[model samples]
Target: MTATAAFEAWAAQHHIDAPHIAIKQTQHAGTGLFAKQAIVTHTEPLLRIPNDMLITTKNATHLHLTEEFRNTIYQLFDGTDEMHLEGKNERLFLKLFLVHERFVHANDSFWKPYMDVLPSLAFFQENHVLFKNYAEHLAGTTLSVSISAKQRALQNELATLQEKACGWLDQITLEQWFWADATFWSRVVSLDEENEAVDNGQATHLALVPFFDFANHSLTPNVRWQRDSQDNSFLLMPFEDATIGAHDELFISYGAKSNQELLFLHGFTLSNNPEPLRLRLPVTPFLAGPSQPAISRFLQQNAMEPFVAFGYSHDSAPSSSSQVLPDFPIAHQLFASTGFTYPSIVLMYLLALDEDDGLRIDEQENIVLGNKQVDAMDGVAEYTSQLEHFKVIQLRVILLLLDALTYHHGELSQSIPETTHPSALTNHIAAYRLEEKHSFECAIDALALLREELLQEPVVIQYMSSQEQQ
Candidate 1:
């Protein structure tokens, strides 16, 4: 039977009598759901999947298997077989592995029809191959390291499972296991309140819903879904009047995800993702200066990390909130208004310093520890007395950030040559980099403007200080 016929048969077995949507192959988006008839806005559910039909870890536990097989699966699930992955992730991998094994090896396996329609592992493997082959092209990129870490974790899990499966060891290849992992990564849905109760909260409940996974993503989605508490089924409906005519594809919003997230998780990048790109800078280096010991102690006492992330939105102002900082209202308001965090932290550190310690410029134009200047304020109260010190710290922090941004911009520019010819792979990489470069440029411009504003503040502070003295 053809793949569509196989899927139809599978749907029929599950009592899905009449689906309003049909699966169609697209050149760019793989398989997606298309409307079979005109769907009105807020129409009744397009599809309802029964609870028993859903494949989840809770349901998978009920499958009858030999004690040895169960033991091996349990070992893999606990990560006692390996040390890196979490127990929850191991359980997920175990479920998918069992599903794939039963589908391929057992004629009596109930999940066979469902498995037959899934896109081959090679379909998803191509993207992984691209990442491996073009590693250098993606150097200095935030996503490259993340992808590498995932790949490593996947390989470790697969190897652990292979070592334990003595009897069925030769039945599956690592490639097939990789495919199973990808299947979980792409299609698994998180359980809502109703479904969570069924799992007793022992583990995170996730399931694979047949036919429902075919709806492609859109930044602006027309479809909405709800989990039925009575029957434990999921109901999909149109949020707005379905402008989708017969044969038009139906789209669902995957939430407001960044382009990088969409690319890695869904294997596609949005041309116009409105979310900002985040750049992380390590605070450890900054903490190494002599006067920063107290700052480090403060961070440790508060259980904060030595890193700060700057989010650069193409169309909005840069955001300065650090996940590491405590959320006191006054500090939060100040940080948000300034549109930067590191500078404020630096300013706070400077204010905390004893008057005996002073800041001096080094040969490299970097701030360094220097001999005490008697003119420096002597105490916390005195520091606050001259509010001009706040502007001084802000100016210094802006200059430091500008230098860092310039370095990153230069690195990204030099990595890709101007005259390189394009291929299919190159085109894909170029698109990803274009978004990254755009974000960097936007951040640079925003920072430059902020520097100008901050420069004027110091003059004002000095004038105000002189006026106060008079």
Candidate 2:
């Protein structure tokens, strides 16, 4: 029997219900669930898998994980925040469990039918952004930068696993570990009560629900998945009044994700995706500048509220002597999709300011303060508010941003080859990069209009006249 047939038969034997849906390989996309019969909306669920059958951390422990192995895995979670413990490496136990089932477990293993159907390591290396071969398609794009970071993190995770789980029974090759991770990220879903219940009673918030994960992602999904606690299963529910035709492919929204996120996580990119591209700009020059500390201190004191509102606030601010800039608390990286991403624009604005423009760091108090001690300098806010200074700072900020965008966009443009026929991976990367460049172009046009308006301001004209007279 084929893999899908075996899985379907396995599901049927296990009481998983899906009377009207069947899995099939698509013409363009990979394997997906298709309707075997016309189904009306608000009717019976298309598919349901009992929660007990889910491949959760708790479930994995019960499979073949020894008491000793489970204890070591639990120790890995030591000192980690009970509430916020989710990342590439945090679920090493689950990945290790999957590896055991895939390699060590025989036909008698309960999870054999499902684990046998998962895509191979070669498939992931060819498709996933985490691998060097596939990541080459995203060269010169911000997604490539993200891919590199994730690759490094994955390697770090491999080292940690090798160090912590020192044994022969469960110690798998890095390739095997990577496959488990790829499968988990691409398939797992968090239970609804995850955030609230993870600390107290919940053993795990995430689960790989078989069959249900076969449905592909769509921005305009006809069906949605929900945890049916009453039924003790996860249910795929159709939207009200949304009729699905016979043989139609089922789709579910992966949430409002950007091209970078979709490419990184799901190994796919949607052309003209409704979400804006997340552009990660190079801030090395700004970070290394002599005024970097002052700029960070200024934003920390005067702009912490706005920074916090933008979700960029760090748990602990970096020391002034630290070379890292504080505004980009995560990685000292700047991510912007539009001129209106206030945090990016505000950081650029501060970087563009100087002592002449009323930016001063008071050593005595170790805080940023406007130079009211200097000639006619009211404060940093007041100095920038003046028409002449306002226009200059605005112009400088625009140019600084435009320069970064142009550099990245040029790299993307150059890396994309000219060919009449291209592979699917090439086409997808080209489309994604073009869309990102479009955002940069839009921002440039908006800044141009703003520049013209600023030049025409009465205060700007008056300041120019005074400068010419002097």
Candidate 3:
């Protein structure tokens, strides 16, 4: 058998779905990683990335050096430059590595001379800074660890990146503007509280996992797991209950739909060849700013604890005669805001109900059933459809906000907090951990406007009048 064929066979045995690439038999940039297919809202896609693909900080560095970074080293150092190495492998590795940006480099002694010469090119040049700073131990010796092929330099972290990006933005003149900076903030909006926590130790640990790398970002994903060996790691699987189509892009999202497939999909689909046909999962297009919140933390903190007394557990309680308690101002305000508010409120309740228990669909029509205890598919549909009535009202409010914000501040609409649920959510004490959320100035303005509009209602007027008389 040919050498590549032999390798392919071995890779297949080792559980590589795309054995051709593993065996170095072919390159797959043209084929792409996914295919076209119809996928249900929750379903599993075959795992293309095996656990083996999970490059560690040490191994990743080694791969960076050996896999393809050789040329840059050879050109920059081997000749009269600085690193005068005489070996064949040294020349070949350096030559190959220059072409491959993703190569993992591991030789500190070898890189030291090159670093001494090329001090200003990149950080960690002379002192073996790469391994000395990022990694604790490699081969039982201290080694510079690359987090993954993606972050070879170990420079970017979600929190730190946000800080640096924002700082840079603040320095820019008013005429200078960039959307990429704003996009980073969106990722910040979705970060878990722990990921962004300040008190957490290990300053350089918050690695940003690429969203497209995982390919799925749902509120409730199908798979769930924690790695048996890796510290601070978890695995995801698709939900067993959801059906996946042939060409859909499968993603591991935040959803805990089933114990079987740790998967999450919004407008999700399953497909055999998903790269070309995967459905567009629900992602807010807006640049995540202060207006957008880290919702997972927000929901966890605000959701009523099962056993806690509703009126007394929180400080903002109201009298018995009150239709809505002060503590539940958001709940009270929902119905009064616009024509769509009622149905939107219903959908929120329905999603909460399904999420609280286990959500299931009817065996026949795939109709969503709430709490195996209650078959409320028709009710859900009615509420979901009624939301359509608010389309005009929603568009108008958005137009008003945009027009107002634009006239007030000579820029196009920066963000629309009032249109979203997370921004509208009050009683958000958790968001102020350590310091108040710096991302919510626009959202706060939106809420103040909403509250002002609500206060004009006759019900609020009557409520205030009665309180004044008493």
Best by TM-score: 2
Candidate 1, after superposition: displacement of residue 167 in Å? 6.5
In candidate 2, position 132 carries an lDDT of 72
Best by lDDT: 2
Please give each candidate's TM-score.
Answer: 0.73, 0.79, 0.26
Clashing pairs in 2: none
Candidate 3, position 97, lDDT: 28
Q: What does the lDDT read for residue 7 in candidate 2?
A: 90
Name the candidate, 2 or 3, with the larger TM-score value: 2
lDDT of 3 at 236: 32
Model 3: runs farther than 4 Å from truth? 1-45, 48-52, 58-236, 254-410, 413-470
Off by over 4 Å in 1: 40-42, 61-69, 77-109, 128-131, 156-178, 193-203, 284-305, 317-388, 417-428, 458-470
Report the Cα lDDT for candidate 3. 0.28
Question: Global lDDT of each model?
Answer: 0.58, 0.63, 0.28
Give all candidate RMSDs, comma-separated.
7.8, 8.3, 21.8
Query: What tens digits encode model 3's per-residue C-alpha lDDT throughout 142-247?
Result: 0111122113321232233234333221232211111111111112111123223111122221222221232334344433323324433323334676554654
Estimate, for each residue in 338-362, the C-alpha lDDT of model 2 and write its tens digit.
2345455555665677766666656
Selected candidate, larger TM-score, 1 vs 3: 1
TM-score of 1: 0.73
